[model samples]
Structure formats: structure tokens, C-alpha cells
Target: MWYLGSWMFPVISAAMWLGMLLGMFIYWEAIGHPIYPSMDRGQTIAYISDVGAYKLKPLFIAGACVTTVFLDLGFLAERWLRHAGRLAPNTSRAQKVLSVIAILFAIAGSAGLILLSNFDTYHYPRLHDAFLLLFIGGYWFSAIFLCAEYQRLGIHYRSHHILRLSFWVKLTFIIVEFVLAVVFASTSYTGKPNVAAVFEWVVALVFTFYVLSFLLDLLPSVRTSHHQPQGWALKAEMEKAHHGGQQPGAPLTNDSAGPNQNRHVAPGDDLEAGAYRGTSMTNGPGYPAEHNDLGRQKRRGIGRLWS
Candidate 1:
């Protein structure tokens, strides 16, 4: 079974975010469920920032800081895993570029979230609103880049259906969040404070789903018996071979090719054998007559040249 330690980061981030928001809502409701500022007293809807801006400011700051930090770390770790070949490697130059761009946007989004938490809407309404835009826009743009990269990767690596699934998941999140954000902003600016507040909460709730979506991207990295060992395991294997006076076995060259196909075939090569042994190909019992003849001829030629 794969060690699931990496899975916990995003899970913790999502759980903390959901718990914090739910706690804020419950706190607001318990406190007489007052109307938002600049709205009629009959209107009970209040923006997350409104509820978070006053007495629960510390909770908001802490939650935002912790959530974004863990989320960023999860993304960074996912990128590292892909590069380290624990996950699928990005085969195209565009895919690599898109990946870097996505990470940059994610970092910007995390920064925006932290900034917004620090600059509360109660005091720095303008700065808070600006940071809110940065936060929303940065993450949405990040998702857009990720969707593009995953789409390309899915097309190239058809067997790994997880890439396709991840692309669709991020695409759906992008579309839904974009629409909700537009409506939320429109309502906020059009004097529909209650409607905006309702949409705001809906947006935050939906974002929790997006935050958790990273788990899908990371699922393919789960170490299995078939997978090649990595990092410390690789080092330990090498050290054991050194102390034991035995040569280490060849590493897996192609994971998607097939289990029995251990040898790599170069383009235009006609050889059909397991692998090269020392100086000659291993022409086994099942090899074709022509290949066997060629192997014998090569051995004779080498013997004559050496003599």
C-alpha cells in the first residue's frame, strides 16, 4: 500500500477551512443573526468577511494563513513528485510552461488570501476588497493553466485516465466558480447586499471542493509494488548492493510499456532480445533463426578482431 502521508496536507487544509467557515456562520447565527451593514435589518444574509472582520478576526486570520500555506505546500509537493518521476512526467514544453505558470498563480492567490485576512474589511475595506479580487482571480487563472496542461497530458498519455479526470474536475471548478464570482460581484455592486452575501458564502463553500481536488492529481503517485523505489529507498538499495558485493538490478525504464518488456528498443533497431549482456545481445531459445545467426556472426567477428 502507498504511504498516505502526503494525502494529509490537502485534507487538513480543506477540513480546517470548512470548519472555520462553519464555525463563523454558527457564531454569526448565535449572535442574533444581525443584518449586514448598509442593508435593511430584515435581511439576515451577511458576507463571510463581514462575520470574520470583527470579533472572529483571529480565527479568520489563522484559518486563512494555515489553509493557504498547506494548500501551497501541497501544490509544490505535487510538482516535485511529477518532476521526480513518482508521477507522470510532463512530456511537452508547453505542459512544463503551463505547470510553472499555474504554480506562480497559486502562490499569488495564497499571498492575496493572507493579505486579505490581515487587512480586514472592517477597517481597510478597499484594500481588503482588492486582495479579495487578487485571491479569486489568481486561483481561477491557476486552475485555467492546470486544465490546459492536464488536457495536453491526457491526450499524450491516453492510458493514464486520471489526467483526463483531473482536467475535467479543474475545468468544472473553473466554470462554476467564475460564474458564481461574477454574480457575487454584480450583486455586491448593485445594492443587492443580501444576495451578494449569500453568493459569497456559496463561493467559499465551493472553493473548499477545489482545494480538495489536488488529491486527485496526487493519486497516481501512490507507491505500488510495480513502481520503482525513489529517493531514500533508492539510496538504501544502492548501499545494500555495495555492502553485499552484488550488482544492483536494472531500474524500470518504461512503466506504461508492459511488465515483461524490460529492455528499451531504440528507433529502427531490429533486435529482438531481452537486453545486451556484457558485449553481445542475449539470443535466447525463442529468438528467430536470423537473429541467432547474427548473434553468432558478431561473436565470431569479435573473437577474430581480438585475436
Candidate 2:
């Protein structure tokens, strides 16, 4: 099980890296296509007004579908692990709630995307606008939820500090992307798509780094370091326990003694108690015989004077 889990992390990271790279290639191709001739700001505005700008609903539909399926799989895996008593009991409540919210949003966004794609209209407004809005909103929410999960898990990838740092960085970029999308929705033409496309590329680059960091941490050398045995710490703890069991200037005995035997000592007794060492006088007497040296001296002096 250990070996398999160790291998799984790298494999998954590689897959994500490849997917992001392919996505970036396709995005670049779309932007540089000859059919959509590059135009000045005024020309671009006039073109959008004449054609009634359309949203890219198909992309949102695809993204939503993928997200929904993955979320379901994640939930199944979580439940299975819990049933096997493998999951930690201290999982954050906020993380779980956010996960559920992301799943719901993905499903709703997927439905909206599909509806907008299929619906036809004589004088209907572009459905891509609505689909884009939902797509950006759903993905933004899901990204936040995923980051929360990472924090809740206390993940600190040994090989890459950038993974931790770039989480917030990517989150900020996503927010910016969402804002750009909103701007595009409001205006007929503002070169928003080009700007959004650039942000998308930036997101892809950050995601690639994120995956690579995970991969580096998963490498055998890195993994070994992370799991290295804390021999010195363990030795120190054992020594402390051993010393705690022994007391200063006391015999180490394993005899079956009553609980109070160590608490109460016979009067004038010289044996040290378990944790108490002070002497005490016997009751119903001025002092015990062993402690009456002054009285004996006084008696001898009176005999000498009488003689």
C-alpha cells in the first residue's frame, strides 16, 4: 500500500501537467486563427454591434461536466476512506461545507451551460454571455474551496515552497479573470477576450508550476526525507520517561505496597517516603526516644549537683 500510494502522487501530477499544457496550446491556436481578423478598438466595437456578440457556451459546458464528475468521485473516495477509519477526525467543517457548495455549483453551472448551448432563438441574445458568467463564477468558487481544503489538510510539500505560495497567487489571478469576464459581459467590445485569454495562459502557467511542485515533492528522494525517522527526538522522550520513574536518594523497589504506604511514615521512622523526605514527631509524646538527647543531658547535670 505504501509503495502504491507513493507512486500515485507523481502519476497524477504528471497527468495534470500534460492536460494544462495541451489546454494552453489549443488556447493559443484559437487566438491566432486567421478567420477572426485582428482589428482596431473602434472596428472591434462596430463588428460586435453588427453581429451581436456570442458567448463561448460549449467551453463552459465541457468544464462544468468535468468538474461535476470529479467532485462525485472525490466524495466517493472520501466516504470510502472514512468507512475504513483512515481519515483524520479533526477535518475542518468549513472545508467539508465548501466542497459540497462547489459540487452543487458545478452541477448547476453544467445544466445552465447545456441549456444555453441547445436553446435557439429568432431574436435571442447570445447565450454565451450567461454561460460565461456561470462558468467563471462556478470555477472561481471551486478554486477557493480547493485551496481551503489544502489549508485544512496542513499540506506542506517538502520540495516546493512555491506550491504553498502560488496557491494565493493563483487565487488572485482567478479573481482577476472573473472580473475581466464580467467586464466583457457588460461591454459590447473592450478587447476583454484578448485580455482574458492572456490571463488564462497565466493561469495555465501557474497550474503547471503547481503540478510540478507536487511532482518534485513526490520524488523518492524527497519523499524519504519527508518521512525520515526522528531518532533523536524519540530517544530523548524515552530517557525522560525513564528518569521520571526513578527518584533521587530512594531505593527502587517493585513490591506490592498500599497507595498510602508512600504518603504516611511511622513516627521517628528514618526510611524516606516515596516523594516526601521530611521527619515528623510521634503523637502523644514530647519527643521520641531517639530525639530526647537534651533531656538525658539535663538529668545527668542534676545528679552531679546533688552529689
Candidate 3:
């Protein structure tokens, strides 16, 4: 289902974060010098790479995280396309513009993260700080717009509790992140770099956990209508396997041709398709809806690129 593909980057990136944290600890053990995650060492996590003994570990981790952020941006764009493709045409032009802007902002944030990671704090403090600010600010703007899109979608699917919950959680997280940022700034002025660093780590950790929640969609056994293959296609593939020499058509309307052979005959239309609608059955990785709100449809990106 498209919902599962939508979670691809979030789940992968969350696991990457966990792996990097573990790698850091292992590297510290090897070097015989600990880099405390919670302690305020007047340095950010990226600064760990500048040290002589275990430079490769943290450096590699930063690079990997940068790659993960880039990939996550694509996932965010894919998620945005769900609404853009479904509702933007019927909705106001302002909403469409906002969605595109949010996608661009996400891309910008990902690029900033790459620069921030590669240009270490020790080597290019000014450049590093600039990209760091870009990363935070760009993502904030992106999230604000994405939440607006969710608001539009939630209006149609009021029964979808998860969409509304995601909206509120994102808003709350953004508020907390900004508050922690202010506290971090104050700590610097108060000569408490340690506390400031701790705030920074808290912000990062909160983001990681926020990302982990993306897997929640996969947990539910909800019948996904989002990206399922047509009933005819599945039957065709099955018939080919059995050498039935039958052209792919709708089910035979008999129990023999239904999903469960042991059960009494259910209509062909009642057959399940979730198992066949894996991520490969998507309308491309980044394009979510093949149908627009007006009942007209395109085969994914067969239409104008901007459209």
C-alpha cells in the first residue's frame, strides 16, 4: 500500500539514528575516551568527529545521517503528493502553492543538513552554524505547511483519527523544539554551555522519536484502498501460474476462484487485494495519487510535470 511506502524513509531513518548512536558508543569504547551523550561538553555531537582517535566513526555516522535526511525529504514529498494529487485541483490555488513550497523547504533542509554535517564545527564554524539554522528554519516552515495540508485532508476523512493526531503532534513538537532552542541560546549567554548542549541533544532525540512514530501506520490492519492493484490483474497473474490459458478477467464468481477456497462463494468484488499491493505497485515512489478530485485521472506523471 502507498501508506507503507510513505513510511519507508521514516522507519529507515529512525533505525539509522539508533545505529549511529550505538556506533558512537562503540567508537568511544575503542578509543578509551567516552563521549557522553547527555553531558554538556561545550560541543555538539558532530564535533566528536574532529577528535584524533575515533574520527572515522562519528564522521561516517554524520555522513550516513545526512544521506538519511535526504532520503527522508523524498518521503515527505511523497506524502505531500497524496494530498496534492487528491485535493489540490479541487481546492484553492493557495493550498497548492503552499504544498509545493513545503516540498521545496524540505529539500532545502536536507541540503542544509548535508552541509552542516560535512563542514564540521571545528573546520567551518560559521558555515556550520548557518546550515544548522537553515536546517531548523526550513523544516519548521515545511512542517507548518504540511500540517495545513493535513488539515485539508482531515476535513474529508474525519474518521481518520491518525491524521488529526499527527497534525497536533507535529505542532506540539515544533513548539517544544523552538522553546528548547531559546533555552539553548539563553544557556550560552549565561555561561552554561553544558546545559545548552544538553538542550541540543534533547531536541535531536525528540526528533528521532518523532520520526519513529511514522511506523504506526504499518501497525494497523486497516484495509488500505490507497494503492491496491485491481481485482482483474491479480487473477490474471494467478491464472498464468496455473496455466489455465484464461485471459485475465474478473473472478469467476465462485468459491473456487475466490480468495478463500474453503469458504462459500463471495462475490468477486469481495476478494481481498492487500497482499498483492506491495510497495512495488505504487504510482512511482514519490507520486501518491493517480486520480484527482474531479474524477479525472492520470497515470502518475504522464501529465505535465508541474501539474
Candidate 4:
């Protein structure tokens, strides 16, 4: 089961990377092949106009938008559920509420992207704009809410340096992206940005980096959460023991860690998958404590907002 998590992280990351690259490639491909190349069109042509004329444009965009939904939803849920069973009752209500809000916004944002792709601006300008608002604005809200939640309580995460850096990086992305979005929107009064094509590309590029950073931290997080079983993962774990002809309470150990590190399954545990109970894990001097400290204390310390 741990092996599955180790592999899923990379598989998910690769899928996300491919989606972004494919989106960029097709977008650029479409831009390069304008049916009316000589038309005296403003660069906003890329943002507001020019659709089917560029044969593959919609295909690429639709594909990209769909892929991004999975990227956001998958990562957000993984991060949230990492400690879902272990949340302490004393944890701040505000932080917990914000976390829930962040997930709602993220899911909404994903839905918005699908709607934006399905309804072209040419025929459904109003609906397209609405979904665009949901896509961009919803994500902005989700990010800020989640970041603020962490800032109020993230000091306790085990990967101290990495967690701090990730939060700040996300904060930076949000600030700069917000500023650029405002600037882009303000230009609507003039009906066009100074360099519409450049402006559009810049916004997309910034967002791409924002997401890419999350890709880096995502794997370690999944691996960290693997130490404690959750949901279906827990079920798989029990099934493995049962299939091995061992009871769920059978003692297990990393042979290399020596007998001192043997871990005996607690009685009454695993009666049902995903039962929330404090689990005892073994650690040895041979292994870095941090690597084995995948307890609820750290996993539930602070939530990551796509950073």
C-alpha cells in the first residue's frame, strides 16, 4: 500500500505536467495558424475573439481546462484528507471553517473551467464571462482563504523549512497574480490591454508556475501521509495482512530497523476501515525521526493550499 502511494504521487504529477504542456502547445499552435492572418485585429483577438477559426484552439483549451479540474480537486482532497481522521477537537474552528471553504471554492473553480470551455464566448458571452469569473475568482478566494488558515496555524508542521517556504511562495503568487488580474481587468474600460496577447500569456504563465510549485511539494506530502492509513488506503492495508495469512494484529517491522522497531497492530483497530484512533508507530535511531514522524501531530499541523 505504501508502494501505491509512492507511485501515485509521481503519476498524478506527471499527468498534471502533461496537461499543462499539452494546453500550452495547442494554444500556441492555434495562435500561429489564424485563418484570417491579415485581418487588422487587436491583440485582444486572442483573449476575446478568434475561436473555431483556429481549428485546434478549442480542443486544446477544453482539454487543458478539464485536466486542471482533476489536478485541483485531486490535490486539494489529498491534502485535506491526509489528517481528516486525526483533527483534534481543539483545533481552531475558524481555521477548520476556512479549510472547508477553500475546498468548496476549489471545486467551484473546477466546475467553472468546465463551463467556460463548454460555452464559447462567441455565442454565450455572458455565460462564458460568468464561468471565467468563477474560474479565476473562485481560485483566488480559495487560495487566500487556505493560506490565511495556514498562516494562523502552520508553525507546527514537521517539514518546518519546506512548509514555511511553500506558504510564502503561494502568498507571493496570490499577491502578484491578484495585482496582474486587477490590471488586466482595469484595461477593460479601454476595451483592450496595452498588449492583450502579452498580458494574457503573462497571466497564464504566472498561474502555471504557481501550480508547478505545488507539484514539487505534493509527492513528499503524499508519502508523509502514507505512514498513517486513511480511507480506502486503510482497507487495502488490512486486506494485505489478511491475504498474507496474518491477522490484522500481527506484528510487522522493517527487518533492517532491528527487532526494537517491531510494530504490533493495536487490538480492536481496523474493525472497519478508516476508524479514527491514535496509532502507535515504531521509530529507530537508524531512521531519521522526521521520516517516521507521520503522526497526526504533524500531518494535521497545517493545511497546504496548493503549495
Which candidate number would show the highest lDDT if scored against the true structure? 1
Q: Each candidate: what lDDT?
A: 0.81, 0.43, 0.56, 0.56
Summing lDDT over every window of 10 consecutive residues in candidate 1, give the lowest-scoring window.
273-282
Residue 115 alpha-carbon offset, candidate 4, angstroms: 0.8
Candidate 2 lDDT trough over 10 residues, lowest sum: 44-53
lDDT of 3 by residue, 13-90 (tens): 776665665565466557665554423455443322233123553554464565457356544544454444421121
TM-score of each: 0.72, 0.44, 0.58, 0.58
Candidate 4 clash total? 0
CA shift at 165, candidate 2, in angstroms?
6.7
The whole-model C-alpha lDDT of candidate 3 against the native structure comes to: 0.56
Best model per TM-score: 1
> How close to the true structure is residue 112 of candidate 3, measured as C-alpha lDDT?
77
lDDT (tens digit, per residue) of candidate 4 on 53-170:
2454466465546556655655564455445632111146786787778778877877886787677666676787788778788777887876776565456443335445656877
Give the clashing residue pairs of candidate 2, or none.
55-128
Off by over 4 Å in 2: 1-68, 71-92, 112-125, 155-307
* Clash tally for model 3: 0
lDDT score for residue 296 of model 3:
25
lDDT of 2 by residue, 1-307 (tens): 3455433443454454455345535553566632223323433222221111224334433433443344344433443332333332224577567656755664564465344434422123456446545645765665566556545543533233433553565466556656655555444355455444444445434433433332322332221434522223334445667766576444556554534455656677644344232323223256564663444446556323322
Q: What's the CA error at residue 125 for candidate 2, in Å?
A: 4.3
Query: Model 4: which residue pairs collide?
Result: none
TM-score of 3: 0.58
